[model samples]
Target: MTVRSIVKFPNPLLRAVAQPVELFDDDLQALASDLIDTMRAAPGIGITAPHIGILKRLVVIQLPSAAKPAIYVNPSVVQASTEMIRHEEGSVSMPGVTDDIERHARIRVRYQDLDGNERFEDAEGLLAVCHQHEIDQLDGLFWTHRLTRLKRDRLIKRYGKLIRAS
Candidate 1:
């Protein structure tokens, strides 16, 4: 496993939809481990395979309160709550900027485990937000898409400045 570099913002691949992970083998597991390593190195709580330029439907999330990271493959939101919550959200691809994006307060996601076992999970709070956010990434929807035009523009501008300064 390796700590793969994150694909930066505006990379066409970040906006490209990820294909479903058909094989649940050692290679997939290695990719998952690499994703975990990459996310931790990026110091992000969540990341998708697309973040590392691998267009596979895989995501890794390790919330501070969790004992370990959760890996989801081909995950999709099966259900969502009527209630909504506004949380500060960002992406490993777009560092140094975040915005309060409203998302469902609770969600039920259907996905596959490392062994290709189909499973479902009910998530709330930050967990729910992470699931939705990553799923959106799988569908080629970057986090900035949730922001208003003005906010998105400003955030992108700030991120551009950060990149230039670096």
Candidate 2:
């Protein structure tokens, strides 16, 4: 297991739609393992294939205090609560930038586990929020998409300035 580099925001890969895993093989499993290691090293709850420059539908997430991580291959939300919760969230892609976003308080997700077995589970609170956030990355979406247009514009400009500085 090893930590992998996270592709930063505004990178073409982050916007590129990812391809689905056609077959579950050793290589795919290794990628998953690497993703887990990277997420752990990041000390973060989630990481996606696109974040690592792999245009494949893959994501890993482990909440704080969770015993182990969970891998989601082509994961999607199957159910979501009508009630919503607003939480402050940040991402490695946009370092130092945090935003309050509204998301479903509870959600049921369907995805393949690390072993490639199909799994279905319900998640709430931070877990559900993290799941949705990572899954959005798979779809080439970001938490900023949920922000107000003015805030989104401000972020884009801020990121642009940061990019210019770097």
Candidate 3:
């Protein structure tokens, strides 16, 4: 597995809705592995294919305490609790920025395993937050979109300053 370059915000591909994965093959597995590697390198708990410029509906996630990363192919939220929770959210693509974003407290997700077997799982707390964030990426919505207009603008301005400084 190799660490892939993460595409930053304002990249056209990050805004493009990702296409579903069609073939579950070695290539797909390799991409998943690369995503895992890249996410780990970014020190992020989650990442999506589009974050690396691949417009495929794939996500890799691993909580801080997880033993290994979990790969989700064509993942979508099947159900979400009405109760909402606010969590500080950030993205591997748009590094060095975070803000409180409201999300479902719990969610049931339907996705395929690496072998293409369909699976369903209910997630809560931080796991739920991560899934929602990655699913948003697949849907062509950056996490920053969850923020208020004022917050989004401020975050973007801060990010621009960081970029210029670097």
Candidate 4:
């Protein structure tokens, strides 16, 4: 397992939909581990395979309070609560910026474990937002797309400033 470089914002792959993970084998496991390592190195609580330029539907989340990371393969939102919550969201690929984006307060996701066993999870609060954010990435929707045009443009300008300053 290795910590791969994040693909970065503006990478076309971030706008490309990821393919479902059909092979539940060692290679997939290794990729999972690598994702975990890369996420930890990025210091992000969640990351998707797409973040590292792998167009596979895989997500790794390690909530700060959780005992360990959770891996989901081909995760999709099955149901979402009517209640909405705006939470600060960011991405490892985008790196330096975040904005409050409204999302369902709760959600039920259907996905598979590394072994390909289908499972469902009911998540709320931060976990719910994280799932939606990552799943959107899988669907070729970058987090910024959730923002209003003005907000997204401002955010991108700020990002460019940060990049130039660095």
In terms of lDDT, the best-performing candidate is: 4
> Please, what is the whole-model Cα lDDT of each candidate in the order they appear?
0.96, 0.85, 0.94, 0.96
Per-residue accuracy of model 4 over 1-166 as CA lDDT, tens digit each: 7999999889999999999999999999999999999999999999999999999999999999999999999999999999999999988987899999999999999999999999999999999999999999999999999999999999999998988999
Candidate 1 lDDT, 1-166, residue by residue in tens: 7999899999999999999999989999999999999999999999999999999999999999889999999999999999999999999999889999999999999999999999999999999999999999999999999999999999999999999999
Which regions of candidate 3 are displaced past 4 Å?
Answer: none
The per-prediction CA RMSD against the true structure, in angstroms, equals: 0.6, 1.8, 0.7, 0.5
Give a tens-digit lDDT track for model 2, residues 45-72: 7888888889898988888778888788
Question: Which residue pairs clash in candidate 2?
Answer: none
Model 3 gets an lDDT of 0.94
TM value for model 1: 0.99
What number of backbone clashes does candidate 2 have, counting pairs of residues 3 or more apart or in separate chains? 0
TM-score of each: 0.99, 0.91, 0.98, 0.99
User: 1-166, model 3: which lDDT tens digit per residue?
Assistant: 8999999888888888999999999999999999999999997999999999999999999998899889999999999999999999998888898999999999999999988999998999999999999999999999888888999999999999998999
**Cα miss at 148, model 4 (Å)?**
0.5
Off by over 4 Å in 1: none
Which of candidates 2 and 3 reaches a greater lDDT? 3
Separately for all candidates shown, the number of backbone clashes (residues 3 or more apart, or on different chains) is 0, 0, 0, 0
Q: How do the candidates rank by lDDT, highest first? A: 4, 1, 3, 2
